[model samples]
Target: MSLLSDPTRLAGLVTREVRTGSRDGVPTRIAVARRSYQTDPADLWDALTNPERIPRWFLPISGRLEVGGRYQLEGHANGVIERCDAPKALAATWEWDGKVSWMEVGLTPVNDGTQLELTHEVPFEPEMWGRFGPGAVGVGWDLTLAGLGSYLSSGEAVDPKEGQHVHRTPEGRVFIRASVTGWGEAAIADGDEPATAQTAADAAYSFYTTEPDSRPES
Candidate 1:
């Protein structure tokens, strides 16, 4: 089934949440998203950990994938694999552009399918949060989950370019809007003022939906 066929429904498949935490006395925010796939845990784990298959859904990954090893995502983040428990849980550092964050993925069996939960923890930046909110990272993961779903359904690779600019398409726009709204609601649930969260969501929505060459003059 094409994810774009029912973009809203596809976006709704994932549940998003936000939480606050402290890392070594520094405040942080965590964004969590959960989505279920029709495939079993083993298959989903293969799709996530197999270097040969990663580019089929997510970015092209290089370097070792085992615990204590470093891996790089093509043109994106590179980090150390801190923990790895096959077909169940994985944790890693997500570092890019001189900043570091933590990420964990857990897979659980659920009614003949698998539930994948992704949690991203980053030090809270007031400016960045006020500017983009959790949608900054949440929506990207939402897209990744959707791509994984598409790939698993057909066993075909997703075109990276099309996936990157999907928000420009009608269905893609709908998907992105729904994702942004979900993140905004999650932020509110995490104690952010509704107006503030909505403002941040608006910024995130524009960031994803605007075409590179079509930016309005400031």
Candidate 2:
């Protein structure tokens, strides 16, 4: 069963399932189509590949974007560029522990705007992944997509730490709460018992909402 059985785990703003697979005893899967407001493929591509433009919307990144070139985010691990196609597609190896996770971003021009798709394929280890719940990865992607969309639309950066606590605002909090519930439903749909998923969802939400500075029993 998918490890996203908890509602709190599923709290990302956008997550579209694309495909799932397994390779060499490692489980690998894909999800595509995230958020981006820019309708022009070239614009979207620049926002993603240009290191200078990336930090304006997403996290700070420093790297050579050419194929087979290595790159790194200021606070993220370094990885090699696996594919690079101007105004259309980009893929790379996301480095972690001498191993690499696969990530791809695709841009497609649509009627209203450009559709941005992000696919990530990593070795799924239930023990580690389950600890954070599905929302761990999902919410992060949602925030990333939102940042990209905002940047493309108004050239504004969505800095969560910049005294504008989006996650704490009423709208932001509601969206997050609903996303957690949706994840709970998804968990049940994925074959987990309803009661178990619900219980896990509550626990996950508490973990996320708790103040980071609060201390537990020693």
Q: Candidate 1, overall lDDT?
A: 0.92
lDDT of 1 by residue, 137-196 (tens): 999999999999999988889988788778878999899899999999999999999999
Candidate with best TM-score: 1
lDDT of 2 by residue, 1-218 (tens): 11122323333536545344576878854434365454688778888888878887667777676888889877667899988888888888878657767888888888777888887766665653344334544444555666676667667655536313555555555555665555555556655467765665555555455554552321
RMSD of each: 1.9, 6.5
Clashing pairs in 1: none
Please give each candidate's TM-score.
Answer: 0.95, 0.75
